[model samples]
Target: MKQRIAWITDSTAVVPDELREKYDIHVVPLDVIFEDGAYADGIQLSSSELYEKIDHSKTVPKTSQPAIGKFVELYEQLAEDYDCAIAIHLSSQLSGTYNTSKSAAAMSEFPVEFVDSQIVSYPITTLLLKGISLAEQGMDYREIAATLREEASKNENYIVIGKLSQLHKGGRLSNAQLIVGTLLQIKPIFCIRNGVVELFEKVRTEGKAFRRIMDQLDLARGIHKISQVEILHGNVMDKALELKETIKSKYQDIEVLVYPLSPVLGVHGGQGTIALTWTNEPKSS
Candidate 1:
């Protein structure tokens, strides 16, 4: 009998809809809760809906991972079809989803290997996409999972907030700084280094921010081999499209794909923000 393998990831991965179905990837949706009500991340608040709601939200939207029981149930069903299952998730430091995934795996009656990605959005999604390709190629589950862990640990999440208004509203940034940024027309540049989001730079305009991000992209490695570039945004279609064009113009050959930032991320990135999700070369390695 041929060996079988299964792939899983959280909603924050920002996977393209067509690829999800094409790869048969199991995407567990995150929970988006408003004071009025709650709904599944992708299913309930489509990308368009998420953006619309974000612009009008007076209160911060809450996010929750899939419960242990839900994880166990999904694992049980998939385990029956596959000889081994590999579950990948966001940073354990950022969210409890990774821990919950591991806990559910331990409780499962079948073999469910959980991987802590330590990265979010496109970086994690890229790892998952690569892992799924390996699995589909008849690689062993352990090999695929180990490769994903290695790649994910080295992935860099470079995010650019076209406006600080969203981060300020979410309380991630102070009101005073937010006001100054607004007056100065500041665009905050950030990147996830060592499992945490760190400020990269502060630009006075959004146009320069785009170039700065692409300049960083040009400096980075590992992206040339990877054909797909994932763009995650919060209520910023025009900005996303413009950035996509910028990427194509500079790279000339590399294709850029945009995916809506899930509600889990919407909590941190305010409306009208652009997050470039891609992997980078380790300075040490």
Candidate 2:
């Protein structure tokens, strides 16, 4: 059989409910465990469900990647139908899912192509979606994966962490720092660097943090064309909407999309955090 291509990604894609079935993309679920048993990220639990869990549990829930069986099963099934599978995964710095997928692919009968998105949330999702688009246009698997990685590496993500309390609960910050930052209403903005999450900047107030984020957008667009943009938030539709409008006005021709943050990300940034991701340069094959 001639080689056919298919795309696969993790649940962080936050794929619009409207688009999943239309595309031949697979969204593998992550794992979350609380006081009792464990459940898949979106199959058995949702973001709202995670919020409730966080409220009642004395300790924050733990998260894990999908089992190796999950990836192997998908690989085997897709191998029968397609020439090879291009599996794009979340950053190895953030989770072990990328490595897990790597291990699964080694044992699978089919040749599985895996990529470390090196970015998180919709940034990586955008890369996978774009690759899928190209694949639909008859792009080769290896070419698709390489293009996806190149484009993803040129992307940038900015997070204006709305609350320190959430990071504290998620164990990203210590009690003393969280308490101090929360007391002073300080917000920290983070950026992804070379596959690792790092501290980017800090602001004294939410207003400044948001303004700085917008400023970065302007600067990035000036340097390169902004191909894709996503605004990730918890429940702050108003803030996200405001940011969207600002983006639309400033870059009238750019494509901008917004969606809620996934539970895994929401846990660390807290309810009102706003994360913006966009391509910093044009992607060429």
lDDT of each: 0.76, 0.81
lDDT tens readout by residue for model 2, 232-272: 88768899999999888888887778888887776667778
lDDT tens digits, residue span 134-190, model 1: 866878778888787788766655677755766666677798898888888888888
TM of each candidate vs. truth: 0.89, 0.93
- Candidate 1 lDDT: 0.76
Give the winner by TM-score: 2
What local lDDT score does residue 27 receive in model 2, on the 0 to 100 scale? 84
Question: Candidate 2, clashing residue pairs?
Answer: none
In terms of lDDT, the poorest run of 10 residues in model 2 is 1-10
Give the Å error, residue 279, model 1: 3.2
